[model samples]
Target chain A: MSTSPTARRGNAVGDAWVIARRSLKHIRRQPEMLTDATIQPIMFVLLFAYVFGGAISVPQGGSYKEFLLGGIFAQTIVFGCFGIAIGLATDRSTGAIDRFRTLPIARSAVLTGRALAAVLIGLLPIILMSAAGLVVGWRTHTGVLDVLGGYALMVLFQFAMTWVGILMGSLLSTPQAVQGVAFTVLFPITFLASTFVPVDTLPGVLRTFAEWNPTTSLSGALRAQFGNPDVVAGTSDAWPLQHPVLYTVIWALTIIAICAPLAVRAFNRATGD
Target chain B: MAIEATGLVKRFGDMTAVAGVDLAVKAGSVTAVLGPNGAGKTTMVRMLTTLSQPDTGTITVAGFDVVADPTEVRRRIGYAAQDATVDELLTGRENLIMIGELHHLGRVRAKERAAVLLTQFSLDDAAERVVGKYSGGMRRRLDLAATLVATPEVLFLDEPTTGLDPRARNELWEVLDTLVDSGVTILLTTQYLEEAERLADHILVVDHGRIIASGSARELKRRIGGEQIRAVLRDRSRADDALRLISEATGGEAAFDADADAVVVATAGGAAAVAAVAGALAEAGIEVDELALRAATLDEVFLELTGHSADAAIEEPV
Candidate 1:
C-alpha cells in the first residue's frame, strides 16, 4: 500500500472509529435511539420464529428455529443499512458535511465515518436477533472459534451494505427521500433472496434470482458454516454442503468498489452556507 | 498581500454568480465586501476562502492556490459562512475541541485552545450545554469560537452580524475589533452599511457580480460626487424656497423630497455648504428644523452606483 495520501485515501478507518464512538456517546445520551436498533430485530425474530415457526418447515430440516436465525440475521443486516442512509441525509441537509469540506481533513472522511458508524450500530440488531433466534430453539453445532468466524463474516456483509447506504444517502435530496428509496430497494432485494425458504422449493424464476442473490449467498454461507442441513448449492459429485463464502466475499467487495467512489463524487457537489 | 485574486470567476450553470474580478487584501487589515442581496458577495467570499471552486480564475490565500492547493489554503484561513454550520447536538466545548482535533492539535493543546476561545467569546458559561439549547447569539458566538480554535492566519466572516440584535451586533463588533488588533487579516461581507462603516479598513462596493468601487470608507464616500446638505423642514411650504436658494447658492441641483421632508443641496463640501445654506436661509427669514453635513454614506453610494432608489416603491422579496 502506498504511504502517500491520495485524494481517495483518507483515514477512513480512523474517522469511522471516531464517528462510531460518537454514535455510542449519542446512544448513551439519548437511550431512546437505541430502542430501534437494539430491540426491533429481537421483536421481529421472536414474532416470526414463534408465530410462524410451525408453518415454515423444510422436507429434510429439523427444528425450523435453527434455520430461521441465519435467514433473519441476513434480513436484519440488510434492513439495518437504512440507518446509514438516514444519518447521511440528515447531515447533508444540515450542512454538517459542508463545514467539513472547508477543513483540512481528507474529503472522503465524512461519508466513510458515517458509513462505519452505521454498521457498528447494526451489530446491536444482529446480536439481539441471534439471541431471540436461540430462545426459539437455535442450536449451533460449531465450536466457539467457528461461531466468532461466522459472526465476523455477517458483520462484514453489513459493513459492505453500509457503503451502499452512504451512496444512497449522499445521492438523495432529503431524509424522507432516503426512507422511500430504502423501502423501494430493500423490499425487492430481501424478498427475492432465500431468506425464509430453501432455494430448491421456489419457482424457477424466483429460485434463480434467489440462488444468485448476494443476501442468499451470505445467509447460505453462515448456515453451512454452522452445520445447518438445508444447503443445496452442491451437486451429487460434490460435498453435501457447498460453500458460498467466496461468493459472499466477492459480492461485498464488488458493492463497495462501486459505492465508495460514487459517494465521494456526489458529496463534493453539495452546496452549503 | 495576504490574499490575491486575478480573474476570479464562478458560474452556476447558465448564471454567473461571480464575474471575473481582481482583488488584493493586505495582511493585518480588515477589508469588507459590501453589497445588497444577490450581489454575489457571499459567492466571492466562498471562492476566496476555498469553500467553493471558481470556474476559471487564479486565486491564492496566504500564498496557496485556492483551486489547486485548497487544503494548504484552508490550513491558513478560518471561514465562518453566512449560515451557521454548527452541530447542534454537540456541546460548545465539544464543537470547538473536535475542530481542534481535526486540525491535528495534540489533546492538551486542543483543550487549551478550546478553553481560551470559550472564555474569549464569553461562551465559557454555556460551554458544557448542547448547542441545540443555545440562543441565536450564543450559537453564533460558539460557531465563531469553533472557527477560532486554530487561531488561523486569515479569517473570512460572511454576514457575521445578520440576524443579530443591536446589543449582540455591538458585542460581535467588539470581538472582531479585538481579533483585528491582534494582527489577523480579515475579509468580511455584509449588506449592513453601518457594519462596513464601523469595522472595515477598506470597503469594496459590489453590484451585479462586479466591483463598482473600492477604497477606504471615506474615499468611497468622497468619490460619490461631493457634498450633501440636508435639513428637515419646519413646514412643507418652505421646501420650494429652500430648494431655490440652495440651487442658486451652490450653483448645483437642489431638490426637496416630500417623503423625507428634507432638502438636498449638492456642493463641493457638505459642511461649508450647510453653513452657507443656513446663513442664506436666515437672511431669507426661512425657518429650519434640523440641518447637518458629512461625507456621503454607503447608503447613498449604493443607491447611486446601483441605480436603485433608497425609498422607491420596489418591495423586497426577502
Candidate 2:
C-alpha cells in the first residue's frame, strides 16, 4: 500500500542527509565508486586532449591546451554520472532498496544519497583531472574566483545528471538495461556537442542540434569563463555566450526537475520484502 | 494490534497474489503463516510488514494506518524478508547500525543495540566480517539482527529459516523464542510445519491467496482425524497375523514397516484398541518390540488437510 507523499518518512532534506552519510560509508568500504569516479574523468581528459585536440583547429589560434580543458572538464563530471546509475541498479538487484522500502527513514533517501555521493565523488575526479590538465599544459585564463565557481558549477551538473542516470537505473529492469540506456542517452548527449570537435564544423542539421544541445552549452559556458579563444560565427554561436552559464544551469535544473520526481515515483513503487 | 488488515487484496496483473483476506495479530505473540509455495503466506507477510499493498484493504500496523502512515508503521515494526538482505560490503555491525539509523536511533543507542543483538543472535564473533564472507546461517542471523536493532514493537520474519542447517535452524529458534518472550509481536511465514509447531502461538494456513485454516498448534493438530499406533514385530511371519488383528482394531488398512520392523495402524478407540491389540499379540505368541501410540504432529495435520502423505509432500515433476 502506498501512502501520499506527505505520509512518507520525516523531512526529505534531513532524510536525504542521513542517507548521504550512509552512502558515503558504503562508498568508503567498497572504494570502487571513488576509484571509478577518479579514473573516469581522468580518462576522458587524457584521451581527448592529447589524441584529437590537434585536428580540431579554431580561428582563435587554439592551443590544444587552452581549447580542450573546458570540454574535458564537462566530460570528466558527466562520465561520473554512469557510476550513479550502476550503483543504484546494483543496489536494487541485491534487494538493498527493497529492504529500505520497509524502513522509517525518508523514502527519497536512497536516490538522493546516491546522487549526492556521486557529486562528492565527481569532485575528487574534477580536482584530479584539473591538476592533471594543468600538468599537461592546459590553460585557464579565468581568475581564482571564476575557477572555483566553474569547478563548483561542474559538480552541480554532475549532481543533476547523476539523478537523471539514477532515474534511468531505478526505472530500468536490470543493470545491463542501465548500461544500454546510460550509453544510449549519455553518448549522444556528450558527443553531438563540441566535446572533441568544434560544433561549427559539423553539417547544418547536426550543427544546429549540437549548438542547441545542453552539453555544448555546458562546455561552451565553461570555456568562455576560462577565456578560451572563441571565433565569431552565426546565430547559433552567439547563443552559447548570451547567458554564459545560463544554458548549463537550465539543463541541470530541467533534468533534476523531471527525473527527480520520476525517480521518487519509481522507487516508491518498489514495494516488497 | 501488532497487525490488523481488513479486506486485504493484492494483485499482479491478471493474478491476485493475495485475495481479499482479513488478518489480525495480537501484540507480543508469535503468529506463524503456514502454506505451500504460491499460497500467499509470503504475500500476507509482505502486506503486514508494509512491503506490499492490498488492492482493496485497510491495514494498520502497530496502531498506524499502513496506507496513510507507513513511515510511522515502519518506525514501529521490524521486517526480515524471506530472502536474506544485507549489504555485502558492510560488516554485520555496520549493517545493523545502518538499519538502526534508518529507524532513527541515536548513534550511541544504535551501537548499543547492535552489540546486544549480535550477541543475542550469536553473531558477535562474525560482526566485523563482511557479510559476503559469512555463511548462509550467519547472514540470516545478521539480517534478523539488522531488523531488530531498533527494538520495534512488531517484527515480521518471512520464511525465517528456509535454508539453514539443522543446528543453525535450532539456534534461530532459540533466538526467536527469546525475542517473543521479550514481548515483541512476531508474524512469520514458513513452509516448515515443525517451525510452526515449535514457535507459533497461533498458526495461519494460507493457500492460493486465502486463509484455509487458523488456530493454535494443539487445536490444529487435533483436527487431523485420529491417533496412530506403530507396532514392531520380531518376525515377518507374524506380519499377516498382526495385520489381521490391527485391521480389526483400527477398522482400516494396516501399514507394515519392514525396514523398521514395525506396522503402523490407526485406531479410533486409541487406548482400548492398544489393550486389545496387546492381548491379541500375547495370545498369538508374537513378541512385539516397539509398540507406541502417538498423537498427530503438525506434519500429520498438514497431510490430513492437504490430502498428501507427510513424508512425500515435496514432490516435483521430473
Candidate 3:
C-alpha cells in the first residue's frame, strides 16, 4: 500500500553499524553480561595455571603457563559463537527481529551487524586473558609483529565463529535451546582439542581427532606466533600441526564459507515468510 | 485504494491459515478486520505488511506491488504487531530513534522525530527510562510511537489493544482516532466489537481464513437481524402471549428466549419498535417485568454469519 513516496534506503554498512551499536550497548548497560568472556575465562586461567599446570608437562619443555595461554585464547575466541547465538536467539524471541525486518534498511544489515558486534565482543576475552596470563606468569617471547599476527588470527577466527553462532541461533527455536545445544557441541569440541591438555597424551582415536581439530590448529598457530612451546611441530607428523598458521587460516576461511550462506538462509527462514 | 489484495492464501503443512482472502482498503479510512482467535486476521495483516509472503495472490500497497516492490511497500507502511515489539532494553526515546535511523531518517532528523513522537504519545516523561521499566500501557504507546517515526501513509495494527487494560485500551483508541482524523489509512484486526464500532469506518468479519462479511458496524449488525426489543414477562407462562403480541406490534420476527424467559423481536424500527411492543403488551394486560431495545453485538453477528459464537473453540481449518 502506497502512503507516501518511498524514502531513501539506508546504506547497508551504515544500517549495520546502527544495529551493531545497539547490541554493544547491552554490554555497557549490564557489565555482568561479560562474565562469559571475562570472569569465566579468568577463572579457567587461574584454575589451570595454579591447580593443573604443575602436573601437566608442556610438550617441549617450555613453561606450561605460557603454552596454556594459546589454548585458552583459541577456546575463548571460538566460544564467541555462543555470545552471538544467545544475542540472536533473544532478538528472535523478543520480536525485535520482526521489528527490524519491517524497516526499509538492507536486510543483510541484521546479521552483518550482529557479526560486527560479536567481533567486538570477542576482543574483550582476548584482552582480559592477556592481563590474566601476565598475572599467571605467561609471556610471549616473539617479535611485536608475530604477537600482532596472533591477535589478528584470533579476530579472524572469531569472525568465522560468529556465522556459526548465527546459524545455530536461527535454527534453534529458543534461547534455552541455544544454550543447551551450543554447550553440548562446543564443550566437547573445545575439550577434545589441545585446549586443556597435550593431544599426544590422549587415546589413539582421540589423539587423531585432536590432531585434526580446527581448535587444535588455532591453538597451535597461536603457540607458534607467540613463541611459546613448539611441541606440536617437534613431535607431530600431522600436516595441520606442522603448518599451524596456514592450516588455521584454511580452517577459519572454510568455516566462514560453509556457515555464512547457511546462516543467512536459516536466518531468512526464521524471520521471513 | 491504499491497500488491495486478492486471493491471498497461506498454508502451513496441510492447514490453510489464510485461504482465498481478498481486500481493498480505501485511503484515509480505518478498516477493522474483525474475527476470533485463529481466524487468520494476523496472517492477513502479516502478508499485507510484507512480513510474510502469500502462497498465492497479489498485494499492492500504495500502488507498489508487495512482491515485486516490497522495499517500496515497506517504506510507505508502518506495522505494529500483536505483541508490543519494542526493545525492552532501550529507553523509550532510544527505541523510536533507532527505528527512525533504520527508516533512513538520518541521525539528526531521527532524533527530531523521536522527540516529536515521545511528546505526542505522552512518553516524554518516561523517555529516558528503559522500556522494561515502563508500564504495559507505556510500552504499548512506545511501540505505536516507533511505527509513526517515519510518518507512514498506511498503518497496520494486529490486535493492538489485545492485552491492554480498559483505561489503556481507551487511551490507545483515542490515539488511533487522532491518527485517522489526520488521514492515516489504517487496517487493524480485533476481536472486540466495541473497538471496531468505535474506530473503524468499515468492518470485515473473517473466519477460517476468508472474509465472511464486510460493512459498516451498523450495517453488519443490521445484516444479522437488526435491533431487537426484548420483554421479560412476570410469569413464564405469558412468554407465548408476549411473543405473539411483540411480533404483531413490531411486525418483525419474534422468538422466545427460554434462558431469559423473554420474548425477543428483531426490528429495524428502533424506538418505534420498543414503543409499539411496550404499548401492545400493556394494552393486552400482559404483565412485563422489563423491556429493552438492544443493537446486535458483533458476537451475535459473528454467530449469525459463521454459525458459531466468537468465543467458540478456535478451529484450525485444514
Candidate 4:
C-alpha cells in the first residue's frame, strides 16, 4: 500500500496514457471525428495546388506546387489546435472533467493526455496532406535526415499548438464558444501569415506581422529543411526566415513555456467552480 | 467520523449557494442530505469530494482535511455526480475500466474489477454497447459502478436517482443497500423524502443552504407530532358525536372532515391513542365503517419545520 514519489509519478504517466487511449477509442467509434485533421486538410491541399498554383509564383526556380506544400502543412498543423480546443471544451461541458478531477490521479495528467492525443491525431493530416501534395506534383528534394527533420519540426509545432489549444479550451466555457473564438482568432493568424502566400505580397502592416508570426516561422523552417522554394527572394532576408529553424524552435518552446502553466491554471479555475 | 464539515459556505458572486452548513457522517452509515434544487446540496457534495474549495469552513473526509490534503481525501472517497459523467462514445465496460485505471489499478486489475461490476450491476448484457446506447437506468448503474471501481470506503452520490423511474429507482436503492451493508460510508444528497426515509440512517433536512432539521426518519416524523387517528362513520348524523368521543378518549381536540365524513385527531400516543378512541366509539354504540392511524408524512414535517413544503422549495427560481 506504500508508494514512493517515483511510483506516484509513474502512475500519473500511466493514467495519462489510459486517458489518451480513451480518446483514441472515441476516434475508433466515430472515425468522422478525424475529418478536420484529415479530409479537410487534404481538400485544402488539392484546392490550392490545382486551383491557385498557376497564379502564385515560386522563387529560386522552385515549382509553385512544391512551394505550396510547406505552407499547407504548417497551416494544417496549426489548425489541429482547433480540434484539441473543441475536444476539451466538450469534456468540460459534459462534466467529464468533474469526474476526472475527483480521482486520485495527478491533475496535469488530464491535460497531458489530451495534448498527447491531439499530437497523435495531428500526425494523420500531415501524412495525408503530404500524400495529396505528392499527387499534385510536389516533391521534397532534400536528404532523408532533412525530410525527417522537417516532419519532426511539424510535430513539435503541433505539440506547442496543443498547449495553446488547452489554454483556450480551459478559458472558454462551452464547446460552441471555443469553436467560434478559435476559428475567429486562428483564421486570421494562419491566413495572415505566410501560409498561403509570400509575406512580402501582403500589405505593409500585415507583412510585418506575418514575418513575426509563428505560423510563418513553422512554414519557413519546413521549406528550408525540405529544400522547397524560399517564399520570396527579398522576403527571406527577415531574421526569422534567415534562421527559420531556430526561430521556429524558439516559438514552439516559448508557447509551451508560457501557455502550459496558464493552461493548468485555467483548467483548475474552470473546474473549481 | 467518515465525513465532517463545520460552517461550510460557498458563494458565486453575490449569491450564496451554501450558507454556513454543518455535517458529520459516521463510518459505515448512510447519511442523506435532503433538499430541493438550489438548496446547495451539490455545492456541499463538491466541497466534500474536493472538487471545489469551501469559501469559509473546514471539512475532512476519510481522516484527511479536504483543503489541506485533498489528494489524500480523493484517494479514499468516490463520487458519482448528478450528471451521468460516463463517456458516451465508450462502451460500458470501457468506461468502468478507464475509471479503474485512473484510480491507479493496473490494466489486469481494472479489467477484472470492471467485469465484476458489470455483472454486479446487471450490466453484463450491455457491457460491450456504447454508453450512448444505454437507457437512463443503465447509464446510472454504470456511473455508480464506475465510482465503485476502486472499492472506496466513502461514496458521495449527488441526486443519484433524480430522473429514474420508480422501478429503476428501486433497483438503485437495492444496489445502494448492498454497498451500505458492505460497510461503505455514503453521503448522498436527494430531494426524495421517501428515498431518505428508505435508505438513510440519519437524514439532514436542508433549506436555503441551512440544516433545518436532523435525525432518523421516525424522529423527523415525531417533530411534527405523532400519528393521526382518523375514524369514518357510516352516518353523517354522528359526526359531532364521533368527534366528541374521540376528543374525550384521546384528550386531544378532534376536527371533523365533513366531506369525507371522518373525524381526525392528532396524538403523540400512537397506537394506544387509536385503541382508546376505538374503545370509546364502540361503547357509545357509534357506527364506524373504517378507522386508521397514519403517521405524519415527511412532507408535513418539512412544512412544519420550514413554514413551507418541500414542493415549494422546488418551485423557487435558481
- List interface RMSDs for the candidates, in order: 7.2, 6.0, 2.0, 4.0
Worst 10 residues of 4 chain B by lDDT: B309-318
Per-residue lDDT tens digits of candidate 3, residues A188-213? 88999988788888888999999999
Sorted into a CAPRI-style docking class, model 3 comes out as medium
Q: Which ranges in model 1 have alpha carbons more than 4 Å from their true place?
A: A1-20, A23-33, A198-202, A229-242, A269-273, B163-174, B231-244, B253-263, B278-290, B294-296, B309-318
Evaluated with TM-score, which candidate comes out highest? 4
DockQ of 3: 0.60
Query: For model 2, how does the per-residue alpha-carbon lDDT over B94-116 read when each residue is reduced to its tens digit?
Result: 88877776666666777888899
In model 1, the number of clashes is 0
lDDT string, candidate 3, B1-318, tens digits = 999999999998899999999899999999999998888999899899888999999999988888898888888888998889998888998899899889988899999999999999999999999898998888888888988888998999988898788999989988888887989899999988888889999999998999999999989988866688888888988777888888889888799988988888778888887888888988989988889998888778888998988756333331
State each model's TM-score restricted to chain B. Answer: 0.85, 0.84, 0.86, 0.93
As a whole number from 0 to 100, the lDDT of residue A170 in candidate 1 is 75
The ten-residue window of minimal lDDT in model 2 chain A covers A1-10
lDDT of 1 by residue, A20-128 (tens): 6655556555554577687777887787787777897755757677777777788878877787777778778876776677777766667666766677678788778
lDDT of each: 0.76, 0.77, 0.88, 0.87
- Position B249, candidate 2: lDDT: 67
- Using DockQ as the measure, the top candidate is 3
Lowest lDDT 10-residue stretch of candidate 2 chain B: B309-318
User: Which has the greatest lDDT?
Assistant: 3
